[model samples]
Target chain A: MVTEFTPWQSLGGGVLIGLAAVLLMALHGRILGATGILGGLMRFNDPADWRLRAALLAGMASGPLVLLGLTGQVPAVDIPISNLAIVLGGVIVGVGVSYGGGCTSGHGICGNARFSRRSMVATASFMVTAFATVYVTRHLIGG
Target chain B: MRLLTAFAIGLVFGVGIAISGMMNPAKVLNFFDLAGTWDPSLAFVMGGGLLVAIPGYRMVLGGPYPTFEPRFQLPDTRVIDRRLVLGSGVFGIGWGISGFCPGGALPALGTGKPEVFLFVTALIGGLLLARGIQSRGLRTKAST
Candidate 1:
């Protein structure tokens, strides 16, 4: 798939995300890992923890509205893979994050920023595999 | 107040993902495809995030405590165990296969696509399965 290179938009979005991460640390004193937050919700160790996660998730769910207000429409998301692939991918990612302790947000953004060796290693590990996976799928198998 | 701040932060994060087009799996996949139609925008996103966050973390963490919380709930483990590497590799394969990381997937839910819901459901199931395995391992360790 020929995706357009979005430097400016991506950079702007990155800044916003960075801001959010900082704010989460500043206020809640928590790391903003998307999968960790979701998994925490399922565990529901405490009402306060659940509430915090729920509020963040609810805000995430409502983000399209914010996009609508800003861009005059809810952005369209394209899923190029099949339903089966999506499910398989999701399950793998779920287990991976549970074992890895973070995904893109946790390790990629928050952990790396803090200069944690573990987060850096985790980021590099995933990135290399992701590159190899894409190479295999798009180039080799032609999926 | 904490909840409100968390919500606002989530909003910002979701908007960032949307604006950067990370919510689209195809775009993300293309980023990984170095040989074919590779989009280098994701690099900028990571760079831009680090540009701000590195300094921000330094400033905030310099303090004894955060504004609302008693202390930072940062990860305390220093050991980079097998679980971290192997699990990350597995997650990376899944991400490359689908182009939907947890961060992108969560915000994409706003689009109200059945596929997103499906992927998320499967992801949740995976998380549960992993947790079960970990707890079981712990139980065995305890028994031993």
Candidate 2:
């Protein structure tokens, strides 16, 4: 349980995320929910929306690469879990995003900004559950 | 113009995620670790994001539709039903398990790690299953 407080980077990055959502909504009339945008592409639900979707996904997918490549700073990702656990986690998240209609950024950030009660509920739900899971997995059971 | 804006927005979004340390599963896990090594960076991220987005949303709402589109393609879902709560709960379990939400994992694609691929495959499969169920329900309603 080594804690590192990176308030500035977190704040800066958070602002950038909000700005991105703002710009996307203002310019394209779309919520910057990555799941919906990417899921739309996966399902090919609408051929008409594919171009913008593809462009956005392409840009987002490459952003981390460009930034990390330039800065040569590969942040540590220390998740003490089996590969099997990762896959299971992914499946749950994917299903949740699809059924719940958004993820953290979408509901926690974007939806909350817009005063959506649904987003609030969803945000609280995930946040609470995630907290509990982490508590049990890390604290109680000693991860 | 629209496509370019969308791309720029995506780039900014990804950069934000990476910079905020949200892309790091451990950092994200830290946020969820309330009873242990809890990290408060996630709160700052949400606050910073909301600070901009709140006013930004007002401006968008006041504008004459979107710049490149006729109408805002916003989520119109109004129900806080069982499905939403259950889905989010399930998602929370997974998120807690691995700490890679869709936003985080999608940006980590460049790493090209097999672990990422495995999670992504499962994720896509999960989405497809949900879609299948949704479409089936829709078809049943239509038939009725």
Candidate 3:
């Protein structure tokens, strides 16, 4: 089902993201990339690193619950992604994000905002490829 | 105190992601479907995120140090090398196919999507595997 335009909510959400990024930077000298945060949490780190990152993950996991408590429903997930697709996507994303050193939020959002040249190029590359992949999968591949 | 703040911000991000419809794969996938029905909502989401982050980062940079930390731990590497480009290309393909990035997918599991759990598992595996290869390369380089 085609979703309707939600300009206001989307923008507001974006603001929250920005706010969160700022907060993270201000509170600790760190950029707020979920992938990086999760990865750091996974790898060996100091006690302080583990504590902060674990709290962040726990908070992220609890966010949906908080929204559900307030609004009683979230946007429904209505996509036809298969199990294989999910696994493949995850593996690629894991390796790619790790290798590239960032993901959508890191490069596309935060890095670009900071006028980082590498982030700018990375964002452009990924957006183009994503668009191409979708075109091929949806239109040509017929999935 | 720091932990509390982390939890609070995480909650905020989760709410924001949900409200922005970032968790909905169909909506996310449609953003990439340029040839078919395209959805540009994510553009607004990114725009909104940048709106605050740009200035927010500036103010933070002015400060001598982070509020809770001894020093700012920002990435300093400026090289636009093969690793960034090739890795991003692979990431983009996966993003189009599954409609989930590390940021979007992580919070999504809270909504009880079993499929997302699978994605997370594989994602971790990929990360560990990459680490393994990198370490081996390091070992070989150091020996030589």
Candidate 4:
């Protein structure tokens, strides 16, 4: 039988994500768009912006670690693809973020939070594509 | 008021993820696996997000326009243009193959898994390529 997700657990996760986004915005006056944070690191030469971007990245990277330390169990993950495929996949995502003007976090979370019409379209497009891709790859290509 | 409200809302959002098991990459990856075992946690996540957002959206719309920047910024375009279609296609392919969309990817890095690093590198490469294309497009328009 498939295990059901508890509503309380789901609510907690949402609360963390929402708080993190809000904290980022409240302190820096910037939205916690992962793509923007990553993009700023690549494009901006300004020291202040760079420092803040680095910190944001660092925080995200450390978040799971903190969770692990507290919970004593890392979340389970099973990816069938090889490491090389994973890297290539990341490259493609980077490209998409560039083209789309934001990553899922930026567009999906903060953008949606702000109710940007573009974000709505982008998020929908991304979700649809993701759904379609999964269907095709797993069903058609048998990957 | 805005800052406090934002924080409060965000807290709720985070709690939702934590509770839903969406914060757990294993749960997310399980959702992606179709052939062996399929988990429908993702559907639940989306359902939950929409459920909260719909009511929250109604509340926001009912309020007066803010003097400063509004808390939400809606997209301006009405059409499902080429960029939207193409970008989404690319994103989906990547997500399908990797099982790590941006939201999950960020949190996954916390595990200190080597795979996360690889995923992140490629994600950056994708972003850079997009920026280059955008800049080139801008330059071409300027020249024209």
Highest lDDT scorer: 1
For candidate 2, write residues A34-142 as lDDT tens digits. 7887698885667769988888878877777778688986545556678988988988888888778899888988899999999999999998888888888787776
Each candidate's DockQ score against the native complex? 0.85, 0.76, 0.78, 0.34
Best by DockQ: 1
Clashing pairs in 2: none
Q: Model 4 scores what on Cα lDDT?
A: 0.62
What's the DockQ of model 2?
Answer: 0.76
Model 4, runs deviating above 4 Å: A1-8, B1-26, B32-36, B44-80
lDDT string for model 3 (A1-143, tens) is 46676788889988988888888989877888888888888877488888888888888777678888888875456666788988888888888887888888888777987889989988887888888888888888875
Model 1, residue B41: distance off in Å is 1.0
lDDT of 1 by residue, B28-86 (tens): 99899889888888888888788889999999999889899899999999889999999
User: TM-score per candidate, in order?
Assistant: 0.97, 0.94, 0.96, 0.76
Off by over 4 Å in 1: none
CAPRI verdict on model 4?
Answer: acceptable
State which candidate, 1 or 4, has the greater lDDT: 1
- The superposed Cα distance between candidate 3 and the true structure at residue B127, in angstroms, equals 1.1
Please rank every candidate by TM-score, starting with the best.
Answer: 1, 3, 2, 4
Q: Pick the candidate with the highest TM-score.
A: 1
Error at A32, model 2, angstroms: 0.6
lDDT of 4 by residue, A43-93 (tens): 666976676566655555555555566688765445566787788778887
Residue B38 of model 1, lDDT score: 84
lDDT of each: 0.90, 0.84, 0.84, 0.62
